[model samples]
Target: MSSPTSSRAVPPSSPPSTQAQPAGLWPGLGLSAVAALIALGINHAVPTASALLVAIVMGVILTNVRPLPASTAPGLAVAGKRLLRIGIVLLGLQLSLGDILGLGWGMIGVVIAVVVGGLLVTEFVGRLLGVRPAQRSLIGAGFSICGAAAVAGVEGVIEDKHEEDVVTALALVVLFGTLMIPLVPLASTALGMDPRDSGLWAGLSIHEVAQVVAAAGIIGPSALKVGVIVKLARVLMLAPVMVWFGLQLRRRGGQVEGKRPPLVPLFVAGFLAAALLRTTGWLPASVLDPIKMLQTFLLAAAMFALGTGVTASRLKNVGGRPVVLAAVTTLAVAGIAWSGVMFIG
Candidate 1:
């Protein structure tokens, strides 16, 4: 648990050379932006595959086919960390405290139960299956919360070198999230649940926000509204979960080399503040619309940046274990969420 920087103490008598580091981030940022643009275009045309998924696939393709330049590493890091955090903060604008509270205590309890239960069960199964601890946490977060965003949030706090695990978890999320778009509706119909309950099920179980929207939309407009609000309820859990993980990391002496993140990260704080601002009715639609656009673009770009971290060799090293873990985790979450929906209704 020693700090990463402790071993390589530099002597103060001979300061390091003042050569300025090259501004290499532009290339990576530019590439990520391009990927995001391509994803947006694809989403517009197809309307099934989410832009976030498209961007991640593009990043993986680029990395495997033609290796990105070394100079782009700095920028890619920026996109993965800073841009991801900023995107998460802006995400708050899409939610409001009033809307979440309106769901009533019974519905809120169901959401909390599913999320907490999903995280615990997934992580336990992961451990039993021999997955690494950090990877297990990332996978659990992805399944229990808001897909790639949740994985990114957990990774930021843990500060581990398991970037491949994050990508693996995200890949699984995209896969099942996509599949659920069709599967959920079928299940809802089979169960004979009304549109409202179906929407709640989708919101609780689906991994990504876009995937929830797509699934709920297929049911009906009423379903879509219920699904989105429920999904936001899951999203709201991200902050406290992140703080708990951060505290766990600190307690276990897992702190990274430098300054540790705040107990409640700055991004989470910004997210709460933005949500409160939205509740105030002060944010005009014109401003909110653009912010929403920017939020999506930023998250897309961040996904692409994370994708660049996944090379063929690394995937080969991981083999199929992560995928299996993802599949099991996804099914567990879907079932648990559905059970909650049934019990509540």
Candidate 2:
């Protein structure tokens, strides 16, 4: 009996992560700068256009390589997206909770009105369009509630929706939201809205915080505070609505064996944890800035991934139902947001 001789040859090259050096700081910063620059160019209505625009540019680069089918992509991208939502929520820390609470509470009635009204109106249109009820419900969650976060949360708990429907719902939220960034201010001025009222309306109505900032910035600084507070209040609604929609999706046969995941508010809890960390002075101001910067970096990376993910053909086929749902729902929400600000303030 003899020991077997070794046959394998060692490779000389470093592994991919090491060989590439993890994309480097400059590449990431360059990506962020490009996003910010593009957003700045398109930011007639808003501040964070950089996120989406940057993502699109990256997406163009990504698609050129012929991506793994989204089904085959690693689970981390999905998780990365959730982390971005948490980052957005935690940005609330830059404000005094007292001020946001003070202003935001008044908008609760309006928030409720917007959330409910938008959903019902959109559902009617989705129903008429013959979209599946469960799928339509997810779209309603986004428009009536918190945009992508709302859509993602409701989707987490509902197994019935086609991935296409989920993608389309998310697309409609971002697509219409980005469009509204510039146009909302123009409409606000055309309607001769008072600055405070317009800010409140823009904050309450716009889909993303970045978009709200852009919309309010177009009005003035006075509106920035009002609008950001309004949007943060709206963001808070992601939890309860996600839970309710989760139950509805289950009732509607959306629940399958091990299909439902926890709702989006769980991530909100992580957001609150970060805020509590800040308030407790557990995180120093010096550290806080970096942590926020980290979150922004993470968000930018994810946005780049999102932009890379979509194909123009896919975007074109996102369906008429969700777009119409978004418009009608926006109208319903805006009207209620106005009424709520008027009544509460």
lDDT of each: 0.80, 0.60
Q: What residue pairs clash in candidate 1, if any at all? A: 25-75
What is candidate 2's lDDT per residue for 82-190, written digit by digit as tens?
A: 4456555665455344555676545666766777777787778878877787678877887766565566556555555554565566667777777878887898889
Candidate 1 accuracy as TM-score: 0.91
Q: TM-score for each prediction?
A: 0.91, 0.73
Q: Can you write out model 1's per-residue Cα lDDT over 21-117, one digit (the tens) per residue? A: 5454576678788888888888889876788888877877877787666546656667877788899999999888889889988888988887888
Steric clash pairs (candidate 2): 45-181, 45-214, 46-214, 47-214, 59-307, 59-308
Question: What lDDT score is found at residue 131 in candidate 2?
Answer: 77
Once model 1 is optimally superposed onto the true structure by TM-score, how far is the C-alpha of residue 170 displaced, in angstroms?
A: 1.6
Clashes of each: 1, 6
- What is the RMSD, in Å, between candidate 2 and the native fold over all Cα? 8.8
Candidate 2 wrong stretches, greater than 4 Å: 1-48, 64-72, 75-96, 249-265, 275-284
